[model samples]
Target: MLLLLLLPSALLLVPWAGAGRIIGGWEAQPHSRPYMAHLLIRNASHKFECGGFLIRPDAVLSAAHCVTGKKAVNTTVILGAHNLKKKEPSWQVFHVGHWVIHPNYSKDKKENDIMLLKLKPRAKLTKEVSYISLPRHNEQVKPNTTCKVAGWGWTSTTGDETSVLMEVDLKVLSEKVCENRFQKKYLHQSMICAGDEEGKKSTSRGDSGGPLVCNGKAHGVVSYGPKYCVFPKIFTRVSYFEPWIHEELRKFVLQDLPDSPSSD
Candidate 1:
């Protein structure tokens, strides 16, 4: 039974993971989902540490748990690269400026697991790099509706990370099934549960913080799932936190950030 859980169980919601693309999925067209952002420690490990998207020219949205205990000065945001392993002309890397984690985020509780990254000098937008629109605060796609998830994470739970972007489509499971599978209060308005109940395809480890694109908008952030990515995947509902995101962006990220090349 696929269910939401308070414990992320090593999938996501634990600090420090790079959300790779989809497992049991197909490669994404080059530059598709251009808002995809890769986070890592510069000159550290060649592996990306998390996945994010450009909500603004200077701002990125990722999992708070992924960046916890790490300094913004030490992090790098890689944008416009479908393949991180190669040097692509469209790729641009930026250092982080503001490290804003949700004030109520609880590592122990594994709830409210989201954060914003301010790109130093902002990010340059090109044909290969663009933005994803956020789901309206009250918008929602019904259960069983198909949504797409993309990432550069592992193609399998134990497989090597894919060098290119991958994509998979998943159905939104009903809340009743989610309630039965997870603990009481595990499913909340701020969170969403969806996946293949048949154990065929889903995002696994190294795919945390990626976007769950539904109805051509970003409605969820890849949070976590079962060990093998079989169980239903959990996502932080973007609609529920619309105010929190806007408040922070309006107060901090909007001011004093440099313009992207396209914007200028």
Candidate 2:
């Protein structure tokens, strides 16, 4: 039996995952997370509120909620960026051609929190820009396995977003532990749990829609986190959605993607 969440909870989706980087993390190298791509809006109030990763030459993986109601034409994806506040030669921006959010994604339940963006002009694979490797279908990460999560999220829970990209290491916890600690009903099996109880590391404000890499393969997507970034973070299990990703990407790039030397 599952208990209904009767509390007046807005379910604050923290924008960043790195605790001032996921609490006790550090700044990552410029090209460490090469696949990392920050999302921006077209308006003058353009903000790097969300994060993403390049899974293919013309496709980017992100959270469905990031573009749920927004116009796809106004969105842009920036890649090879080490710092958002500084101009770097490695950074390149591209317009979004199409938005492919998961069909079953729900705003209320936060289920299937994944989406894919098609770039207008395919990105050129370079030393500072490349695609991340996705894991095989249905692969499950064992408990206590340390994985890497990087983003331009806030440096602290209540702080502003980080100017430089931040990367942090988190240990994967079993689904049962996450359910028991939080609301059992809300924690879906398609989600992965990873965090530190010591309040040392966590995903903070504006770190959503980033990748969670384990054993050198992207296996999770930063979907949500606890209030104020104090508890373990919840990520959409990438392995569980492998089929959706492959299907969506195949629609764009049917031919084989050229192999390029990655510096990440």
Candidate 3:
């Protein structure tokens, strides 16, 4: 009777709750391909990892949440390598000089989810530690365009975390489809959507703040996803935030580039 009805409802709710945790936390399948570098944050006692890009010799751009609301500045940015669990002497470990989280960053809405880290010493640009080009201002990528996303986050809906960098091909979707899928939650002008319609390849939990690069240029930063970790990955559009990025870069130049002109 009533007990049977309630039991069925409880069973139905179990999967939803578990799905929420899997999609919301740092857990997923392992990816096969690697394309991005991740910055591992380790304090004296605790250790946490996040994704980032070597945008310059002296600066690494990542999500603000990755730096702020964390432990002391014993952070190390691992460059040129992906497998964190392995011991690779070739990978560089940089001491963090300073970090700047976007002033307008909102944890609830995830607005302005960008951050910049200054290394104690400048890293040399080579075949491995090269900088990725940022998108130009006013550049608008149309829907259905193919793009690539890479990170060291989880791979599948129920898989182990990845030690090596993982990359997947994604397709940009229309804002309308994104809004409908996510119910317009945190989907704004500064963000765009990408992924497969059938939940093929997409960003999952712990993939936040990674690069959604397209056309050899970084176009978005991983932001949010849907209930089942399916398609339609919401990404913060880099082009819309070009001005802020330039301003931040200028600040870095002023601090790091003593010989260069202040106007840079």
Candidate 4:
């Protein structure tokens, strides 16, 4: 039963030939539902349809590549959200006061592909919009462990957008099996693999920067998908980056505002 829950989506390796084409002036279909969500920081404009988790009242964790190649000053992080197509009464938009990408991040290999964003103003905590706890360094989740992945990415290749926060059960995969499957071409120590190896209901496009959570804690950040978008996908391991995260958080707290309280 645990293994079955980790199944990947059948569309992993399938190609969307027209994925590059834009329809209705929208880069891609708007995620079906949008609420306090992360925005994809592109060169032109930002879109609030990706996954993210509030790590602090004023901080959010997401994929580094999401904001790469874009100006940090112009970036924005939309939170307290619920619907994407239309504005909700609780939706709030905050400017990205600053951003910190892992210094060792590699676009070619997509290593250490995590990033942290500091929002202009702190968010108000609530049940609908809240922060996810960070996993302790050295904490390990055994293989076949059931977890949950949430995102606002595309639902299907030809299907319409997905809800603001769609969650699916998943399981962790052993490093050995993961390496053998991807030939180590994408998997790295800083990343963990999850989903059904057989490809049944996996994460896909626009899901990048989302969270792979377990026991109410954030264990990984969505990074890459199967080249074909078929099998289990890889996520940046949050545990391995604990030191860097703390350092960045400390720097942000000191420089941004001393009065800012720590989430921990």
Candidate 5:
């Protein structure tokens, strides 16, 4: 049986698998992934980072655990960034206007682990910054599907987090295989699994909240992995939350519209 451990907590004792990097991946081409968003979040005690991706002109999709239950006091989204350590001309920074975590998110079970951040001012779309398309309505990916997962973080379990963006190719595993590997009670239906079986390549301590892009569509949100990231990792299956995402986007648009004129 596999042990159940949160990536953040595991990172303290086991410096490798937590809410931050890519393991066994290579540097991504600058601005190649325009939808990518790097998050700098501060709580009362300290500051941390998480990965996210632009989903709309003013919205970003990420893991709920990245913000909620962490006492996140303030969060900033940086788009069009290639090397986080350098302030490039393409960077578009925005203060979070608001955020919405899934209503039924369960920290213990790690279910419904997704969230959306609304930018204070809508982002200006350009060649270097835009939104990634989501999975088609109710679409599902099959086993053995090759996908890409990208983020700014460690490229190895024992390595330092990288400043430049990195990405790796992963293969989706079947639901049955995932259940057999992870604790059944902790593994929810809404989550998907992906990674290399040999453990050669996987998401590590800083890759959380990043996307699993399958066939050019945003299909999953990086959730968690084992202490050493030795096998396939868990991701919040985006298709499961499509309806809720669309609904929230609709509400946001409605809120932005001017009030209707008074009746005569």
Candidate 6:
């Protein structure tokens, strides 16, 4: 009976294209990644997860597909959390006040897949909560550059979901290589390709929208990957959209600040 039941679960390991999660990675040190944000999004029928990072007290960066058809009322952003199952005192929860998806984002083409979330109430800066820096305008990452991505979700296609966050290091690949693999129609210049050449490490289902941190800065956003999660994954290049990000943040990131207590 056990074998019978387990057979169905085993079939889930089969390859299929979908959102990705961290694979071949270990648990991240609690609260070490202070800017990490875990998003819980709901559609009409069910809830799903995505990853994001804080860019400002009131602004977060994620993939457009994570919220393409979702409503603000059904979305929740959780920051300062290392373990999603625990009631960590450092956790900060917020509702999305607004969403700013790239105007050219296309779900089918998977081009320009980026989005920003404006927190309803600005996140309070603390030891476990803060923001990360973005790359300079048009600053591009070279092929073979090493970067790290983190998120909380399935450890493998057939494994149980991880309660704590996880991360893995991936090496960027050349544009020519990516274009060859995904083709020009799918792999736009605005995207990045990264993963282990041997297919040992990758991002599998549930890790979409996470940050790809390189040199202490976020350079990419997790977008999609292969069905088996064995090949290189594609990320929305952060540097390519720096100008648009700045313009959006400038509009309302500082609005309605709470007054500080007056000192006599």
Candidate 2 residue 79 C-alpha distance from true site, Å = 0.7
Candidate 1 local lDDT, residue 156: 70
- Strongest candidate by lDDT: 5
| Candidates 1 and 3 compared by lDDT, better number | 1
Better model by TM-score: candidate 2 vs candidate 3: 2
* lDDT (tens digit, per residue) of candidate 3 on 1-264: 222212221122111111111122232233222224567677677765666776777777777766666675577777767566885655677767578888888765556777777766777765556778888875888898998776665666775566666666778887777555555354557878777666556666555667878888888877655444455566778888888888887887786565754321
Query: Candidate 3: what lDDT?
Result: 0.64
For 1-264, candidate 5 gives per-residue lDDT tens digits of 134322333232221255457877898999999999999889889877889999999799999888876687888899999998899889999878589899998776678889998885789999999999998656899889999999997776676768999998999987765666565533545888888877677887766899999999999999876665557688888988999999988877876778933111
lDDT of each: 0.74, 0.74, 0.64, 0.64, 0.81, 0.80
Which lDDT tens digits does candidate 6 get at residues 1-264? Answer: 223222321222211243567878899999999999999988677787899999999889999988776553478899999989897889999877578899999877778889998886789999999999999987888888999999888787675689899999999987766665666444555888888877667787777888999989999998876554456678998998999999988766445445633111
Query: Each model's TM-score, in the order given?
Result: 0.85, 0.84, 0.79, 0.79, 0.89, 0.87
Question: How badly does each model clash, as a count of residue pairs?
Answer: 12, 18, 5, 25, 6, 6
In candidate 1, how many Å is residue 117 off? 0.6
Q: Which regions in candidate 1 have their CA more than 4 angstroms from the true location?
A: 1-21, 42-48, 70-73, 257-264
- Expressed as tens digits, the lDDT of each residue in 105-149 for candidate 2 is 987666898999887578889999999998888898888999988
Better of 3 and 5 by TM-score: 5
**Cα error of candidate 1 at position 44, Å:** 8.3
Per-residue accuracy of model 4 over 79-177 as CA lDDT, tens digit each: 765445567666677766577889988766667889888876777765556777888885777789887765654656554564445566678888866
TM-score of 6: 0.87
Candidate 2 TM-score, C-alpha based: 0.84
